[model samples]
Target: MFKWKRKKKWYRDFVNPVHEFRYAMEFVEETLEEEKTKEDQILILDFILSVIREDLKYDTLTNIFYREKWFDEGLRISLPFPYHYYDEKGNMLSIYEDKAEVKKVDLAKECVLVFPWHRGRMRDNIKNIGRNEFQYDKFNHKAYYFSPVNICFVYNGMHSITAGIGFKKGYIEAAEYDVTKLFEHVYTDGLYWYNRHNNQKLEDDLLDFRIGVIYEISKIKHHIEKDAT
Candidate 1:
């Protein structure tokens, strides 16, 4: 009887996994269908805008990066740094130097200091951001910094870059706040036009740490202005 009961429980556990797998598959399929519809609408809008005669104006605000060509190469450009560096004595280092070094040494009963090697790259760990598709040209010295708040929109045939700001958390809030504002400024003065375009809603789209740092800087700037007043 014990063996029979054990077999029954094992069969029940095996079936449960299959059931869960089916449910997840169905959810993913539904999401894919929704995304396809949204993409279709955006393509349609692009076609319409291409032939339109009226001047197409979009909101320039809320874009974290400036829309400019940094080099002759086909690349979107933005300034990512307002960085700060300090030494062991808390002295700020100048950017003019080729290399900065820190040093320390130990003798029999005393301590000595010597310069340790240090080199800084213009772009460090830029892959942490969402720019996985673009290749960085280090020799050009154009891709200097990476900004969490700045996103560059580049078209296939376009040489100029359109700068925009986006949260790491997909497009839910961006659709509501940033995209909506852009559409209103461009398409019509009326509201809710961009909100209607959104179909798939992300469940857990939240601000990333890098974006949080940008917000903190804004807050600091606000306080400084307030204090000045």
Candidate 2:
């Protein structure tokens, strides 16, 4: 009798988009069990695992790296810091630098405080309230459309960050006491917009830490992917 044997993948361990996702998570788990890590490295590994372990739709929704108008194609994202979304465009136009060494002051010096969320990109902050509602303050750089959905963008220093019940496809602006019990940390659960404010409700350390890990992972995935490629 003849039997079929499976072929092995030639890519780096836990690097491919397919089965590697599970391995990626395992790698992180093993890393944790193997030895202790610094906060920065922990942030990176946690994020990577969170993203890789998501379902398909949610995973696609989370890839908000490259910075460019919908028209740009040949462009791809490659950076250490997701200092800016559509980062390649930002780099070409001298808007945002992509070095890990750049301080928050550098971003402030350029008058850019925070980057907007791309397709499935998210923001990480610790607050008392919840709901994906962006504050409409003077420092606000992104443009927001409050219609059927919260559509946002940047044109000449206009960008947006939202805090509300928004879906994965668009943005929303909610109140401090607006978050529903949702899984903001699960990779494939899709993004459930949430932000906190001065109005205290409750605190879930695990949730906060997970959301933060998601941001750090999303921000740094491109750089890791580039390195692997």
10 residues in a row with least lDDT, candidate 2: 102-111
In model 2, which regions exceed 4 Å deviation? 1-16, 36-140, 143-185, 189-229
Q: What would the per-residue lDDT of candidate 2 be over residues 1-229, giving only the tens digit for each residue?
A: 1222222332344343334334444565565566554454556564554343243213222234454433322223222111212221222211132111211111101111123343322334212113344343434333221111111212212123322212212222221110111122212211122222222222222222233334334434434444456
Which parts of model 1 have CA positions greater than 4 angstroms off? 1-79, 94-141, 145-159, 163-229
Q: What TM-score, computed on C-alpha atoms, does each candidate reach?
A: 0.17, 0.24
lDDT of candidates 1 onward, in order: 0.25, 0.29
Number of the top candidate by lDDT? 2
Tens-place lDDT per residue, model 1, 1-229, is 9999999999777764335334433443454356455444334433332322111112222121334323334333221221222333544432213232221111111111111111111122223223533322223211111112122222221111111112121110110011211211111111111111333222222112222223223333333345556
RMSD (Å) of each candidate, 1 decimal: 24.6, 19.0
